[model samples]
Target: MTVSNNSLDVAVLEWCKLMADRNDKHHWSHVVTDAAAFEGSLLTAIGMTKDEFAGYETAMRRYRDKFIAHLDSDAEMDIPQLEQAERAVAFYHSHVVEQEAEGIDLHGLPATGAQMATYYHAEERSAAIRYDAAMQPVAG
Candidate 1:
């Protein structure tokens, strides 16, 4: 796949994982839903205004609900989702930097969505390779 294709696949896969985890019986959805509920606080924490944060959230939600989860027939995948994902990833990175600056340790935090996506894509590629190898004719 081309670089763009690989990046898009990673974004779509990451979005799918987010949706699944968020909707599962476990309290994962709390991460996103709860954060959204405290939009004011989170915005302040992230150094973003409500409008800027809303733009990011809207991009992600539209991509998730319309393209990833529901697959709305009228909705077409767009660059906004990719842009928003990159922005969100950067937001998280800033938090990490801030924590480090404050002398706080982050040994147990979960990997960022972008990191998870890379790991998932690697696993997928490995599985495909194994499957293809298994399907090869035996050289008796």
Candidate 2:
């Protein structure tokens, strides 16, 4: 249970980072030709329309900025309990996981929490590298 809870915390934080990064104009400007088009592609790939993605991103960013990113004195962030975290994971598995999977059998075998944590860490590291590469000034 502890492992699962820790895994959930890591997953949530990873997702928060993804949301925050995607919404950042600086990050988007570094990689894509048209930000809106790139965002639309991302939203479609994630099984959400532009408006839906906007609402979800807005909420996630609010929580991320208030709680995870800074220790804002006046920010009121509602941290989810373990039960809520479990429910969120279950919900994602049921609804969102399939959409994200591309030819991979996500439901075939469940990975342990430790495995997931490692995977998430690797993914974050790779994403950071990609972001840095995109931001580098191109030689003429």
lDDT against the true structure, each candidate: 0.54, 0.52
Q: State every prediction's TM-score relative to the real structure.
A: 0.40, 0.38
The residue pairs in collision within model 1 are none
Decoy 2 TM-score against native: 0.38
Q: List the residue pairs that clash in candidate 2.
A: none
Q: Please, what are the lDDT tens digits per residue for candidate 2 over residues 77-137?
A: 6654333333334433333343434446554543444555567579768876876777789
User: Candidate 2, which ten residues in sequence have the lowest lDDT sum?
Assistant: 82-91
Regions more than 4 Å wrong, model 2? 1-26, 72-140
Best model number under lDDT? 1
RMSD of 2: 15.1
User: What is candidate 1's CA lDDT for residue 107?
Assistant: 51
lDDT of candidate 1 over 47-103, digit per residue (tens): 668687566656666666776567688745764545444444545444444432233
Where is the poorest 10-residue window by lDDT in model 1?
Answer: 25-34
